[model samples]
Target chain A: MPAQSSPPRTDSRPGGRSARVRAAVHQAVKELLTDEAGDALTIPVIAARAGVHATTVYRRWGSVGELLADVATSRFSGDVVVPDTGSLREDLERYAYDLAKDLSDPDTLALVRAIVGTGGEGAGVCRMERQRQLEAIIEREQGRGNQVPTIERAIEALLAPLYYRAVFTDQALSPEWARTLVSHLLPR
Target chain B: MPAQSSPPRTDSRPGGRSARVRAAVHQAVKELLTDEAGDALTIPVIAARAGVHATTVYRRWGSVGELLADVATSRFSGDVVVPDTGSLREDLERYAYDLAKDLSDPDTLALVRAIVGTGGEGAGVCRMERQRQLEAIIEREQGRGNQVPTIERAIEALLAPLYYRAVFTDQALSPEWARTLVSHLLPR
Candidate 1:
């Protein structure tokens, strides 16, 4: 048989070239943020680092604030792993503690602050990721015949305080605080 | 005797010319923010508007972000009035609803976002102001012989959700939502 060579195809699927571009751009932003002061960050610098055209970066991200929000939200989405500890209280406490720890990181906190500061669309994405994780935990609890609070209640009572402290206050987020919040949410 | 004329003294007291200068600078920032795009705001422009030296503005405020944070915090401090409705639930609900309404203003929200984005000292000032208001409400409830949740609990149950939704979610902050949060915090 003659040598069969596949032609170079333009992959425009959502998870194909588009996803790759986003990953590269996000990675470039992270590297740049780490290597340089935030004041030194700009679209052209990021585009150069990512090996993408500055116009493409600008068209996709709009501004440095929006781009930072996207990168931060994506980092949260990837880093968070919802626990399946089988007990709802334990699961929530673990999740909350992990979230508190993650948010305590300076870089992560900066990203979160950027997301809120930018008031961009990334906040919704971050909220949805947390909602999905909570829903999974709630579904598991339901299957186990345990009474659970509504997702809205869980969000208000459990998630809100953690983020509130992280963003607005100088209060420390401890494991005990996470446990207390979970206890209040899943009261006996 | 020759007419005794008082010497011109530099008013450096806390609420004297120093305070006047600060007020003028903050007012200039507010007017500039309202009149121009945030990108066009700079120390020199703000100082020029305030009729102060650019070096003075720079030395005091450090950057536009800090200046915006100061303006926003001072605005909140001056604007917020803690309710005394003779009932804890009513007071909390009214306060929260008002807060939601105030935060809904585009300019106020932008100022808040800037404060968080800047990660400056203004967050501490804002938190302290809210804490003082909460303490007043708590003391009033205590004087009435009503069993009230602790200030920490009130913050977690009542205040956090409003800000959480305002900053992070697309959820509407309705009077009913505020009432619900109050009810949760102070159950009958």
Candidate 2:
């Protein structure tokens, strides 16, 4: 979990050179992952793309897998707005569809696979973000005096199937499939 | 998917030196995965342990990730005995519990994560094996004149939650949890 936290900034100044370097490195990693074969992704190649010293890149991110994990975490948390459609079913359906779409992207899928491969704090961070979003939706439903499934139940019913298909099977996820999962979770 | 098939044997003789070499290499990979840190795993190290030349290892396996994937596929398919308890509910519960217990082992979990990371044919091979087992159970239930859920539904309800918790959350899966999933799916 230590790697889940951002490393301390070498320069304490706001909007400083350290922040710039981190941003450049992350961008470089994403671009490489998208445009090149996975085998072509190495420290020197990424460093060259970012216009940073290979040692600097190596020092900042111990390995390519860790660098990919960092980028994946930022992309997962920063993007994807949680829906608030008032109805729990609608909210969940929209959320699932969005997730399915995101995972369908080759780059995003690669990032997810990389995170799974890295096998540590990265997956935990992404899971926490997902849990937080689900909790918020549940809390809102409770305030509206509507019965809703537990967050754990929601995850088991709604999220797991989508991810399982995305990662394991070649099955293409669709909006209809997303709606089906939500319906199963909250049958009318 | 090409890698999913075993490479042609250099020695066409049945139970020949090629077969022994493959066995030794697989055993060496499993022992290294169990005993050493993932970082310590390399073609040379595994070759040394297997008493095979590093070039031979590389020529056959290509990379450590692929080698790990091959071992994982063999382990996943070979070790588990699929349940056939006549009753669908009992069969599913036993299956889930066994899967949970297997994934709980650190070595097995590491192998699974490695397979996922390798991405492509390895995950497909494991999924196909699981699907085949489920199909067998469903077919047996049908033969017994009992109604059963589709393989897709079984996967969504029974397997997805187990894998999701294993890979994403730190949640410890229990026998009760496995039974609960089967209950939710069967709903008697």
Candidate 3:
């Protein structure tokens, strides 16, 4: 007799069967979001795209809004460390440029569009996540004995402009522009 | 009689009866949005709240989504002007702080929520309007001549931080923080 076969699975984690299924569903959602525009967002489409049962999608996220939020949040997060160069301006300039680069990337931009489609309802929470990231960076700088005031301000200086350019201006945040911003602000 | 008398209307606009009616409807829609959350957004509810004929709202905007977009767009605009302080850093710092204050204000926050609730369908256009305002400020600064790369960077440094703080951090753009940001980015 053939040896008992192990369950077919795709997830690399040790969370077992449900985790594997969830991982597949999550990946499918991310792909759909990346490929489609805001208007194309829907559950059946996502389920079909992921090759999962529609009920699985519903069970995982509870709603399409939540699912989109999860995809965007996951895609945009994780330990994005802030680099320090002693001078606050230089440090901040690098920080800002890197952030602009990250947000302007194709996958990230798609995630932004998805979250933005939901408008300000989810914006507050989203903003909170960003704030946490900023706070961590600032605190790290402070731990190095940097002046809190200068470093905090530098953090703002670096990031707000790129976002203003993206969300308010509808302009892509270019590396040249980032370099220009950093150069003037840091001047080192 | 010296002249035929017209009835005093709740709408203050000068026009024929239809125009007055339209104004009333618009006002009503605004009030409803201000008071209710996203889930409460609906045509019949809006019509009843506005006290204008429901058909007029539909006729003017075509659908609930369209009407909501129009209302959100019409209520907020990208028209903020940055004051010139003869120092780029100072001006930008003021601009950043003021923008945060404005965007986070109760009225503006509500408007943002309304816009976001629309699922970012109109976000691109709205962002464009905001960009025009920022560009206008930048253009005015450039008009002063003697434009330096550092000053330009200062502009982004000063402004971007506040927005990043507001939209990303979910924290109120504090005046103290603005001052610190300006000091660090601007040359002494």
Best model per lDDT? 2
State which candidate, 1 or 2, has the greater DockQ: 1
Q: What is the TM-score of chain A alone in each candidate?
A: 0.76, 0.82, 0.72
Residue-level lDDT tens digits of model 2 in A40-158 = 35678889999999999879888776787678678878566889987887888888888888879887777676667657666776567767887888889999998879888889998
After superposing candidate 1, which stretches have Cα over 4 Å from the reference?
A: A1-28, A31-56, B1-56
Q: DockQ: which candidate is best?
A: 1
Per-residue accuracy of model 3 over A1-188 as CA lDDT, tens digit each: 98658875565357776766667777876686565343345577778877888897878786666776766566556656656676555555566677778777766655554455444334444444555666666677678886554544444555567665665444678877776665654454
Give the residue spans of candidate 3 off by over 4 A. Answer: A1-17, A20-37, A40-66, A77-98, A116-151, B1-69, B77-98, B113-155, B179-188
Top-down lDDT ranking = 2, 1, 3
Model 1 clash pairs are none
Compute the lDDT of residue B177 as modeled in candidate 2: 91
Q: Report the poorest 10 consecutive residues by lDDT, candidate 3 chain B.
A: B112-121
Q: Which has the better lDDT: candidate 2, or candidate 3?
A: 2
lDDT of 3 by residue, B9-70 (tens): 55545567667666676676567656634334556677787777778777777655566566
| Model 1 complex DockQ against the native | 0.49
Per-candidate TM-score against the hidden true structure: 0.80, 0.85, 0.61
Q: Indicate the worst ten consecutive residues by lDDT in candidate 1 chain B.
A: B32-41
